[model samples]
Target: MFEISPTEWTAILLSLRVAIIATLVATPFGIALAWLLARRNFWGKSILDAAVHLPLVLPPVVTGYLLLLTLGRRGMVGAWLAENLGIVFAFRWTGAALACGVMSFPLLVRPIRLSIEAIDRRLEQASSTLGAAPWQVFATVTLPLALPGILAGMVLGFAKAIGEFGATITFVSNIPGETQTISSAIYSLIQTPDGDSAAGRLVLISIVIAMGALIASEWFARRATQRLHGN
Candidate 1:
């Protein structure tokens, strides 16, 4: 059936909201980390790289449990935040966003790192010789040249956030109209009697969203390539 129920619509909207927030919140940090990995050498560089990528290797449930321990209401950080700042993450949509952001962070960093690594150092050297400040050089030259990769990273992160399930449900417990995302809703639907049709609809919607994001990413990548080549 082509009809989507109100609950399904809520889940869809909530998924979009969480994905967008996660992407926006993670982007600046992603760029900075990508730049560091691409352009700088430092103590514990390997450790940092491994840490950034740890999520990809670890079970999502483990990540979520770790987050709960560190950021739940009674957690060390969470308690301090709640006491001092009235902020709470456990069982909240904000918590879902945080979980999504953490899970997708590596996706947001890899493409940008590759792009930055691909940049010609000679171009940077040339800019420095022209007396451009480091910040100015990065803002004007490095960032612009790396825009395509940054965009790609954002899209990838967004897609990852949209589909995130294990971490989100573990951290926030899939509360409807709050933390219940499309994936979680579909999961709930699948467990109910005669819920196959609703579950199927959600699956179709998920496919459409994922495909759209992939198409957009590819189109943007092509456009960026064309622009780079002055086509």
Candidate 2:
């Protein structure tokens, strides 16, 4: 009952690959946006925040369709990239990664924003008073203090990416050995004859991975809290 086939293994590996790439690629932007939301009050701040979080409120299929419209081969930016840079997103694994990253983006921002907000401004001010540049103060003070939240956000993004289906399928169309992630594979299995066993195995694997990520996030957060408290 627990035997996983080669196809299942492929799906598992692909899911991991997509989730890791999505999380890493999204981290820097997530941090920047979180910092902006938490610290800077500029024009259109509310609009930017709403845009970052629009995916959460929007249906996954709707998000995926929007990506298709903007990132598909014939899409404005997509066509330019394809013609100029030989890059394409439509019907490719990279597109799957893009979809996952966008879907998981909000998850990656919220915790980091909260962490940045919780940081005592005095610490940053002290660093600034000590002749540190703004970037240095952020690198030294803000980032270190917010590490736990960043880690948590990454894990959350990975989890969301691994489980993403609607957006990925809609954007990339579930091509095997390329865009077919575990969630998509499971979806295919459920629609196929005598695929129940295989789908069950994949479901179990998904559960294990998600649980492990959650556990790791909790541990990291707890450790960070302890360190912050000097305990």
Candidate 2 TM-score, C-alpha based: 0.98
- How much lDDT does each candidate structure score? 0.92, 0.93
Name the lDDT value of residue 100 in candidate 2.
97
lDDT string for model 2 (1-231, tens) is 588899999999999999999999999999999999999989999999999999999999999999999889989888988999999999988999999999999999998998899888998999999999999999999999999999999999899999999989999998889999999999999999999999999999999999999998888788678756767
Pairs with backbone N, CA or C atoms under 3 Å apart (clashes), candidate 2: none
Q: Per-residue lDDT for 48-131 in model 1, tens only?
A: 999999988899999999999999998899999999999999998999999999999999999889888877778888998999
Best by TM-score: 2
Query: What is the TM-score (0 to 1) of candidate 1?
Result: 0.96
Q: Which 10 consecutive residues of model 1 have the lowest summed lDDT?
A: 222-231
| Alpha-carbon shift of residue 170 in model 2 (angstroms) | 0.4
All candidates: CA RMSD (Å)? 1.2, 0.9
